[model samples]
Target chain A: MELEALSVGQYSFIQNAYSFGFAVMAAATLFFWLMKSEIAPAYRLAITITGLVTAVAAYHYLQIMLSWGAAVDVTSGEVISTGKPFNQAYRYVDWLLTVPLLLIELILVMRLSRQETIKRTTVLGGAAALMIVLGYPGEVSSAGGLRFVFWVLSMIPFVYIVYQLVVGLKESISQQPESVKNLINISVYLVIGSWLFYPIVYLFPLVGLEGGAAITAVEVGYTVADIVAKAVFGVFIFMIAMRKSQEIEGTASTVSKPAAAAENETSKPS
Target chain B: MELEALSVGQYSFIQNAYSFGFAVMAAATLFFWLMKSEIAPAYRLAITITGLVTAVAAYHYLQIMLSWGAAVDVTSGEVISTGKPFNQAYRYVDWLLTVPLLLIELILVMRLSRQETIKRTTVLGGAAALMIVLGYPGEVSSAGGLRFVFWVLSMIPFVYIVYQLVVGLKESISQQPESVKNLINISVYLVIGSWLFYPIVYLFPLVGLEGGAAITAVEVGYTVADIVAKAVFGVFIFMIAMRKSQEIEGTASTVSKPAAAAENETSKPS
Candidate 1:
């Protein structure tokens, strides 16, 4: 891309956008690095890396935006006429970065759940992965057919996630602590809400939105919500994992208390 | 907020945005409600009320978008400009709903911390409150001055929050659970990162972003990060809260266990 040749203003836009992207990537990377020793750090790492890569792509695009702003539009390759090449390049990078992250997160969730013997984790994780993969064609396609395919793929994960949540709730209803239940319920809503965003972004514009504005608005909105749901929600899930680990430790101590006390008494004089 | 006459497309764009907004609001409300007995139920009620209001306002904006799209752009304001006005109106409502919620969450944390006799909670909570109040001006003002004010104000909570976490680490240096420490650290980064976003968004555009596109991009990125931080981080807080409460209960049970056993032995016949 002609990033090196941009005007001062374009350079600033790119710099700012890139800086923002860098912050995201750096934070994600650092967070994962810190979490590496935990039970399921790979998923966290993948997610963070995705976030990091996305930030890098975003920064590049911001650079493009700065340069292209004076000449034409950011997406349609409008303003500078020369801007299309760079814009498309960045857009492709953005997609490539995000899609894999989504897949990795799903796989990680699946593996973790399987370890915990949660059957639904695999199904839901697979569905989420499938949805992401299927949606790609629609995402990259010009003709709405790719979108339709993507929507169907995406819906599977949404449904699976909701299903896993429902099952989790039912299982928890018997003996789960209120906090655990709350975590599960809230996490479900977050994931579901995120999944629902795709269709809303893709299909909602059919009514009255003209040209690229609707798409732009949808993209912007979804990106914001997605980031929030993934990162923030990911944190919550980690907390839950930790909480569960703690509970197991607590139970172990409780169960061993009597035996430990008897052994202590035996060592003392009668 | 001329929202009565919407074309299908404009209506859809506005509707989808509002839908996502409503989902977030609803999830937050549900979470607050679930934890009402622990925190203040009143706050949850307030959030619910605010969310409902946002939903209504969203509906109104959808109509406005529809009308704007359907009508020709009359520069003289001859034909009602539904687009910008409604969009601004929606943004205003969003600000009203969220800013208050942020403050409320901080207050709730302070109140709970006080009840638990955690000194840092009160101080940190107070700082957060002050920041939220300061952010109001920043939220409203489009000027660099206002933005700077809000930026500084917002930073205060982050600083306080970090202080609180660091102190927690210091207090429990030897005994602090790895999970708790990791969670706290993640939160510190997430919150601080979000706090830094406003300046970047405002300042970056001055260099090159002539149109609203770059500003919008920054806003979108900020919103995504912020939402993730708040809601997702909020979940971690919830998990921690639940864990803490459970720990409290466990301690209570352990403390009373021997006494109860002794009482039972004394009452039994020889």
Candidate 2:
């Protein structure tokens, strides 16, 4: 199965998949931004960042879909020979914008200290962006070895990201309210698990999938991963934020009582 | 464009879209079932039913995808004439099982009286299932007039469902805690809004869309609607359940003071 043998129908399918993903992401963005909630400021920022991540991805996916559609003859479902090539770079562009924000938002929702948040966000966010940038050459490369080389280069940052999330954040996560500790752990695992799909999709060509099947697998695979990473993960983020907000409120109500008692005694007969 | 002019690529796209939707639904089902939460039993049942809805839809969608994939000659991206006809019936089958569960779940989460639950679930669920059954004949009919007639028949039940959800549930929803009241309203609206898409998709052919375009529109449209109806709506259900659970706890602590005081009096030195 050579690249030239890829049908226009496959491209249409890919384009439509992207289009669907974009629509969902855009809707989620609106939801996270517009929905009423009494969550804390830190978590509110997390929600806003979640929306931004999806919005950016939605914009890029729209571009990717357009590029794919432009390359196909819609009526016949055939790839036009003379049309502009499908812009695969749009994915990398999306990742560059979203990957860092993904880490930053997660850190924000944790409501860690300013120093800790800054440290983790800088290290993890930078690594995430670097991972995407490193993966780009491989994504666009036709040569198998070049793709593999860039993939390996990209994995370094990915591994670092996993470490920062899993190991570096361990103590802080452990100190979170018991209700949301498990949720935070699950969110971390969700991020790590969904992300692993990208590398597998990247390596599909090496596994003997070529042309239409490979393209279909890659496109479908990425779309699935994108939904999980953006929409589903956003749901988890919102849940965590809600739980943490409740916890803060509960603590404030309990802790304010002693202070109120002391103020009553001081003011009563002085 | 005639239905026969529907291209292999279009079918491939539709099949893949269904597959993606199935994967997400299955994952969501598991999340609802397995995730740790402190929601009440009524709400927990709601969560379980949410899972069941998606799980059934996912299974049927898998069958639909397989039927579509079997019809396609993957290598050439062409639909084979002799292959098993794409199982449009699977959608109806799925709706029969899940649509009723969807209504029942919403009623259960509202924690209505047993009689009210039964009454609402029976009327709403029965209407929902009937709506799907009525629409199926229209979906399969070649004659435009027959399809239109069946579609009109289906809308009767749809209007009934809207009435029950919006009007019948009004008092019960109003009695819910303030935190969850808006959510219940939104959930009802979400259900009605997402459902309206199905009728629109059914009537697309009547509006001059035909062949590949109509098929594409219908499949993609239904896929989007399904995601919203099941997955996105489930998220709202979970949120409402969480808030209600918190409210229940809050009220229990505050309202139990009299009983505690009475017990203290009974146990005193007298």
Candidate 3:
């Protein structure tokens, strides 16, 4: 919380990162929403959630940029504190709201059985919220010991989510038309890989980075991760929806994946 | 905006209304969500929106109760402000977020033409948000004349919504089975009838009631209306979903409703 004078490079890095993050999220929201009608009716909700996730992220990124502008002052050549704390909680708030939605988007796009869709969404969405809630206290606390404890606690849910994405939804992902099955798999990994950035940035202060360096690393790291996790992953989800819609409409006979397998897979416990 | 001391009766009345409101919204959220799988897949999103509307309402009602608790104290026998402004904005915030969803729920359940669904939801949902936004400035201001100006401004969108709800979807309602046609029709009336409570409450002070009396009237009136508009309307939406699901799954043949007539209804513009 101390007033650390930030070098111009350090200050500009975060500002630009936030600006880019906001732009991508807003763009993605518009893209997913506009394309919703093109998706199959069954999968339209998936696109809607994707739009909502990006829209929520876009709002928070704007808030982050405004908070950064208010917290930093560059009127005297060097960027330094205006004695206001940069509002870091916006990221957590954004995650708390959108993280579950992100998971729901995945489940909805799968077009699983009705009961399975409800079950998966409830469990995965609940776990996402739990993970974010557990991580917040550590995010705000300066004490490394307290932060580490909460980080470990948060990783419990994180691990569960990773397991679900990697193994639990494996069959559901496999049952998709052969064209998109692999893409959905890659999107799942992208979620896991990008989500890991949060905890890594969280540890920068614990691992010898502090002051302006810590702030820049944390902010820029999270922003970059968010762009990939939300924007990039969202594109894949959109593609999956688009391709699946096409496969569903363009005659189910064209898909190399056998129809009987998909029908049988629907009956399996998710 | 000087603090007014409320009698114990007045304080208890608002407190109890909020308690009941929160309970109803929370309960409706659980009911609609848990019963989701029972609804037909096409109608499930409408039920989901119903759950979200109530969940959002539940949260704001909790906030309103906490704000009421903090703003009023009866420790010295008469209730008076603790100097913190009771967050009256929570009401507008709740309405702003949930009102659009309420209209969207109606559209989704109608399962209108895809293009029509998109068009009606975009237009109607956008209008609901505009109505809420226009009403806020008036609610916060003590200038009766200024409030009157906003009241009229807000009425434009409100009238548009009432038109859409009462007459705009008339064909869709008539196209349903005899069992639910009347229920859905009554639900629309319930929506129109309940929504009028807010403006009536908004005009309470302007119409000569003031101070504790006005506060009591507004708080209690909005609470009652919210319970009906959200919780009650939500139940009706759920029933519509349930009946439609039954009609879809039970035997599309058992109904005397002509398939050709209903099929033709889908081509009509919303």
Q: Which pairs clash in model 3?
A: none
Docking class of 3: incorrect
Report per-candidate DockQ.
Answer: 0.03, 0.05, 0.05
Error of 1 at B137 (Å): 9.1
Q: Per-residue lDDT tens digits of candidate 3, residues A1-270?
A: 443546888888889999999999999988987787776554666777787788768877986798788777786677667654566777876786679878988887876765577689889999999999899878777789999999999999999999998999988777666788888888999999999888787777788777877777777889988888888999999998888766555544554432223333333443
Best by TM-score: 3
> What TM-score does candidate 2 reach?
0.56
Candidate 1's DockQ is 0.03
Q: What is the TM-score of each candidate against the true structure?
A: 0.42, 0.56, 0.58
Tens digits of per-residue lDDT for model 1, B104-146: 3433322221222224434554665565556555544557676
User: Against the true structure, candidate 1 has what lDDT?
Assistant: 0.44
lDDT of 2 by residue, B1-270 (tens): 243456867866777789889988888877776652556432565676677677767766776676566444544654544332454666676686678778877886776543466578889888998998898778777689999999999999999899988888887787665667898889899999999998888887787777787788788888888888888888788787777666555544655432223222222222
Ten-residue region with minimum lDDT total, candidate 1 chain A: A259-268
> What tens-digit string does per-residue lDDT give for candidate 3 at B83-197?
8888989989999999999989988887888998999999999999999999999989989998998999999999999999878888877887776787788789999999988
At residue B161, candidate 2 shows an lDDT of 93
Tens digits of per-residue lDDT for model 1 on A80-180?
Answer: 33433434334435544453454344334323444543444445445555656665666556566556766676676666556755664365333544435
Per-prediction count of colliding residue pairs? Answer: 21, 0, 0
